[model samples]
Target chain A: MTRDSSSTLPAPPALFDTAVVAGVGLIGGSVALGLRQRLLARRVIGLDASPEVLREALALGVVDEIQTAPGEWLRAADLVVLAAPMRALAPLARDLAPFLNPHALVTDVGSVKGGIAAEMERLGVRSFVAGHPMAGSERGGVTHARAALLENAVWVLTPTDHTPLTALSRARTLVESLGGAPVVMPPDAHDALVATISHLPYLASLAMTHMVARDERLSLLAAGGFRDLTRVASGDPRMSRDMVVENKGALREALARFRRQLERLEADLDEPDELLAAALEGKRTRDSLPIVKRSLLPQRHDLVVAVPDRPNQLGAVTQTLGAHGVNIKDIEVLAIREDGGAVRLGLESPEDVQRAAGILAAEGFEVRGRS
Target chain B: MTRDSSSTLPAPPALFDTAVVAGVGLIGGSVALGLRQRLLARRVIGLDASPEVLREALALGVVDEIQTAPGEWLRAADLVVLAAPMRALAPLARDLAPFLNPHALVTDVGSVKGGIAAEMERLGVRSFVAGHPMAGSERGGVTHARAALLENAVWVLTPTDHTPLTALSRARTLVESLGGAPVVMPPDAHDALVATISHLPYLASLAMTHMVARDERLSLLAAGGFRDLTRVASGDPRMSRDMVVENKGALREALARFRRQLERLEADLDEPDELLAAALEGKRTRDSLPIVKRSLLPQRHDLVVAVPDRPNQLGAVTQTLGAHGVNIKDIEVLAIREDGGAVRLGLESPEDVQRAAGILAAEGFEVRGRS
Candidate 1:
C-alpha cells in the first residue's frame, strides 16, 4: 500500500474505499452520517466495544456495517477515525497498529489533541491528524447523528511535522465539504487553546454546579442566571472528566488566573464608589454588544412588502405582489393573529414595493412597508 | 409622624410620607420608581453622592425629588432604602443615624445581607430588613430602571430578632406589591446561600474571562459558549467586587468546593472510563431540564409555533389568534427569514390553540400544531 504524501491534497478515490469509525456515539455517528451522506466511501463500517451500542448504530442507520473484531476492522479499512474517549485513544491505537491499513490516514475528534497526537506517533501512526469539530449541543447519542451538525462550524485540524501533506489536505477537504471552516494549528498549540476555551469553561461550570449542590438554599433560589452559568455542567461527566484530567495543567493555569481576577474584584468591593463605577463601565460595555454579531455576508437589497395585522391580509398582499410582475425573493410574516397580521415580502428591486402596494390596495387587503 | 403597628394592615399614609432611596442607580431607581408606580409612597426622594446620577435619576423620573445631603434626606424619610454598594452601606448607615426618622424602616438591596444588617444595627437602626431582589439584567443605570423590574422575581428578605414585625410585614407587602416572591431567611443563611449561587458564579465567570484574555488565540476562538460562560464577568466590576469582598468567607468556601470538583474531574479525566461515564450521566440529566421552572403561581401558557417558509404568515396567524379572542401576553419571534419563521406566543391557556388555528385557516395560512 502506498501512502499519499501531500497533506493538503484531496483523498484519492481509493483512499476511503473502506473507512472504519472507532466509536458509534454522537460525534462518531455524525461523522459516519456525514461521510455516507456525501458518498465519501464505498463502505463505512463501525467498530465499537459495546455490542449494544454497535447494534443501535446499525439500527439507527449510523453505519452500514459493524465489525465485531477490532483487528479485523482495522485490517480492512483504508481510513480510520478514532472517536473514542480521550484516554481510550492510546490503548486502542496501540492494539490496532499491527493490523492497521498501512496507508490509511488516521484522525481523531478528541478535544485534547496534543496527548492523542503524541500517543498516535508513539504507536507509529505519524501520519495521523488530530481534529476537533467545534459543534455540539448539551445532548449526545447515535440517534442524534445529523449531516448538518458541522455546517458553518469551526473544525480545528492539528498537524505535526510528521503529518503527510496529502493526509492533511484530504482531511481539510473532507471537513470543508461537510460545511466546516477548517482552522489549522500545531497539536500542542491546539491543545492549549482548547483547554483555555473549552476545557476550562467546562471545569468552571462543573465547579459552579458542585458549589450550588453543596448549598440547599442557593440551589433552590437559583434562577435563570445560575441555570445559564451551570448549563454546561449537565454535559456527560465522563467526557468532562476525561477533558479535565487530560488537560489538567492548562485548566489549573486558567483557574489560577480566574482566582486572581476574583481577588481583584474582591478588593474593589471594599471601595463603594470605585466598585459602582467599575460596574457601570461593565454595564456600558455589555449593553453595547450587539445581540447577534452581524453575518459575514451582505444584506440583499429587495423591495419588501409587509401585511398589516388583520385577517385575510396575506392572500391579498401575495396576489398584489404577484400581479405587479415583481419576483418575490423572500416573504416573511412578522406576526400572525386571529383577526389579522403582517407579512413582509422581499422583491428583487426597491421599485417593486410601490407597484406591489398599488396591486395589493386593489385586492382589498391592508398592506404596509416592510417591517 | 405616626407609624402603624398593625402588621396585617396596609401601611398608613404617613408611613412612607418621605421615602428616601440611597445610591439612586439601577436598583435604587427601580425601587423609587416601583414605590411611585404602586402609589406606596407620598414622596420618593433620591440620595446619591454623585450629582450627575442624582440629576439623571430626577430627569428619568426615577425619583420625585433629589437631596444633596444624605443626612437631610434620611431625617425626612419614613422608609429608607439603602440601594448603595455593600461596602458603602456600613458608613452611610453611620452618617444617616443622626438624621434618621426615629421610626424609619431601613433596608437595602445589597447581595451580602449579614454584614450590612450588622452595620445598620450598629448605627442604631432598630427596625431594618436586609433584602436582595434576585432581579436584574447584566445592565445598570437609572436609565435601566423599570417599575416592573421586580415583578414576579424572587426577593429575599433577611430580618433579625430586632426587626419590628410591623416593619418586616410592611417590607413583605412592598415586595409583593412590586410583583416579587418574598423568600424570608436569616441574614447569615442568606449571605452564605448567595455566596454559593450568585457571588461564586460571578467570580468563576470573571476567572474564565481572565483566562481567555490571557490567551490571544483562545480568546479569538471564543464563541457563544465562552461568551455565555463569561457573561457575568462583563457585569459591573464594582458590584462583583463588593460581592466577593463582603462575602469572602462564604465565597471562598464555594470556590474551594468548586476547585475540589475540578480536581475530581481532573482525576476522572486521568482515569477515563469511570469518570467519562459519570460526566455523560450528568449531561443527560441537565439536557432534560425544563426550559423554565413552573412558577409558584399560575404562569402564562406559551406555545412555540413553527411555521413553514412563507410570506405574511405571522400577520395571518396573529390576526387569526386575535380574532378568536386570544390575548397575546407576550410574543417572541424566535427565527425570521425571507421565506418563513417560528414565533412563540404567551397565551392565557392551552385551549387558545384550537381557536388560533381556525383563525389562521380562514386567513389562507397553512397553520400547524403548536410546537
Candidate 2:
C-alpha cells in the first residue's frame, strides 16, 4: 500500500516484521540490538561494507543474521534503517531502492538531514524518514553498542515538504518505542540548530586541542584545564572530518562567526565592558541548560548534606531517598576540606525534597535545605 | 634579620607571624583561610578595595582581620600574597612597596607572569615571587573559598632574573605548606606556556559560548554539548577579561596560531587525510594528561567496582577504602545502565588495591582492573 501524500494524519501500520540495518557500526548496531530488545521487529538483519564488522556484529548478537548487500536482505525488510556515515547514506539509499519491499518504511541515523533527505528523493526512494539520534561515543563500533544508548536521548527528525505521512508516523512510533524523545523540525532548521549545538563544539574542541598539540611545553604538560576542554577531541576523527565536510557551508560560516566574536573579545580586552558581559552572558546561557534537564523530571529542588569523610555516606543517603520513592535529579560530592565533603542532591521537586530530607535526617544524616 | 641568599638550601625559618592577603576573593580568601588552617601564621589579615567583600571575608572567618587598604597591614606582614586580578597586581605591589617591611616576602597568584614581573620590577617591588595556582572554581567569592582549595594543586612560580632568592625560598616554602606542589620557570617561559594552555582554552570557550549566545534559539536550547565545552565561560568575566588584556601579546599570538590551524582544517575538509591525523593526534594529546594526575598520587593504582543503580554505592566505596587506610586518588561513579553503575576508584598504591578490592568484593562488589 502506498502512503497518501495529501493526508495530514498518518495511518498507523503494523509493527515491522523484518528490519535491515545498514553500516552496523555504533549507531546501526544499537538500532539492530534495540529493535530486538524492544521486540519491535521479529528479525533484525545487519549489513555492512566491512566484513570484519559484519562478523563482529553477528558474534556480538546485535543482529539475528548478516547480509553483505541490499539483494540479500532489503526485499524482505518492512523497515530499513540507514545508519551509515553521512557520505555513505545516499549511495546506500540508491542500492536499496531497487530491492526495497513495497510496504517498507525507511529511516536514517545520519547527523545532517537536509542534504540526505534531498539525496534520497533524487534517487527516487519512497517512504523515507530522515532522523538523527543525538547520542554517540568516542569509541565507535558494534562492541561499544548498547541496546539502551538511545534511551532518553533526543532523536531529531527532519521532514521536507515532499515527505510521506505514513512513514513519519512509523518513524515517530519506532523512536518512542525505542525510548527516545522525537523532535520534529524542518530539514534546514535541524541542520542549523545542530551545527550550533554539535558541530561547532567539535570545531572548538579541535581548535583547543590543536593549540595544545602544536606547543612543545603545553603538549608535554597537558594538564586538567586542557583535558576538560578537549574531551570532544577524542571523538572519531574521520567521522568528525566527514561531518564538517558534509555541512561545510554551515560549519564554515559558524567558524567564521565564532572567529569574529573572538576577535571582538580580543579587541575589547583593553577596555572590557563588552567582553565582560559576553563572558557572563555565556555563563548564564550555560546555567540555563541544567534547568531544562531538571524540567524533564517532575520539578527540581536541591539539598546539600554534610557527610563525613567515610565510606557509604553517599550510599546511605541514596538508600534513604530511594526507600521514599524519591529519585535524585542530580548529585555532586564536593570535598570542602581535607576531612569532610558535602553531598549535594538535586531532588525531583520541592515536595519530594522535604520527605527525602526527613528520611535522611531521621537516619542520622546532616541534611541542609528546607525545600 | 635578612634572609641568607648564598645558601643552596633555604633554612626554612618560622613560617610566618603575620600574613596579609589582598583581594579577599576566591584565591585571596582561600590563601587567608589556608594560612590559618595550616597554622603557618599567627594572624592572617585580609585587604580588599571593596569593603563589602572584605566584610564577607571577615564574616566567613577567612581572615582574622580586614583592611580597606594595605597601609594598616603591610608593614607588619611577614608574608603577603597578592591575589588580586591581573590589572590590580602592579598597582597593589606599588602601593605595598611604600609601606612594605624589607623582611616581608611578596608573591602573587596572577595567571600571566611576565608582564606582572616586569611591572613589579618597574615599581622596584623586590622580594617578589610571581605565582599562579592552576586551580579555581566557576563559583567565586569569600563564601565559596575553602582552606583546602590549593591542596595538592600545581602552583606555577615565575622567578625572573631580578627576583630575590629569599622571596623564591619563602614562596616555595609557603606553597608546600599550603599543600601545593611548586614548579619554577622563567617569567617569559611561564607567559608563553600559559598562553597556550590557560589563555587559549578560555578564548576557545568564549568563541563557542559567544556563537551559541548570539543565536536566540540556540542559546535557549543549548544542551549537553554546549554545556561541557563552554564551562570556562562561566568563570568570573572580569578576571578573564583582565587575563586576556594583561597577556594580550602572547595570547594574541596563540589565538592567531589556532586560527591558522582552523583555516587549514577548513581548507582540507573535502580531502581530509591530513586533518584526520591532526584530530586523532589531538585525542592522543588529551588522553595523556591523566597520567600527570596519577603521578601526583603516592603510588598509583586504580580499581573499578560494579554497584547497583541505587544510592550509597559511592559512600560505601569511599568508606571501605578509608577504613582500609587507602586514600582515594580519584573517584568517578559512572552509570552505564538504568539498573546499575560502576565505581572507578584510583587508590593510593598498588599495595592498597588488593586489600581495597578484597574488602569491596567481600561486600558483594564486582571488582575489575590490573592496578
Best by TM-score: 2
User: Which stretches of model 2 miss by more than 4 angstroms?
Assistant: A1-14, A49-61, A290-371, B1-13, B49-66, B219-221, B291-371
Task: Give one digit per residue, the lDDT tens place, for model 2 in A1-371.
Answer: 12222423211122567898988999999988888765567688998888899999989889988888778457889899999988788888888788887678889999988888888788766688899887787678899999667766778888788778878888887886665778888888878777777777787778777777666567644566667777777777778878877777777777778788788877876667777787787777666665332233233355667666556657867876887789988885533344555665877767777888787766666665531
What TM-score, over all chains together, does every model reach?
0.68, 0.73
In candidate 2, what are the lDDT values of residues B161-202, reduced to their tens digit? Answer: 888887898788788667677889998787878788778888
What TM-score did chain B of candidate 1 earn? 0.72
lDDT per residue (tens digit) for residues A71-129 in model 1 = 65567777788888776878877877778877887888888887888887888886688
Local lDDT at B199 for model 2? 80
Q: Total clashes, candidate 2?
A: 8
Alpha-carbon interface RMSD for all candidates, in angstroms = 3.6, 2.3
DockQ of each candidate, alpha-carbon based: 0.23, 0.33
How accurate locally is residue A97 in candidate 1, as Cα lDDT from 0 to 100?
Answer: 78
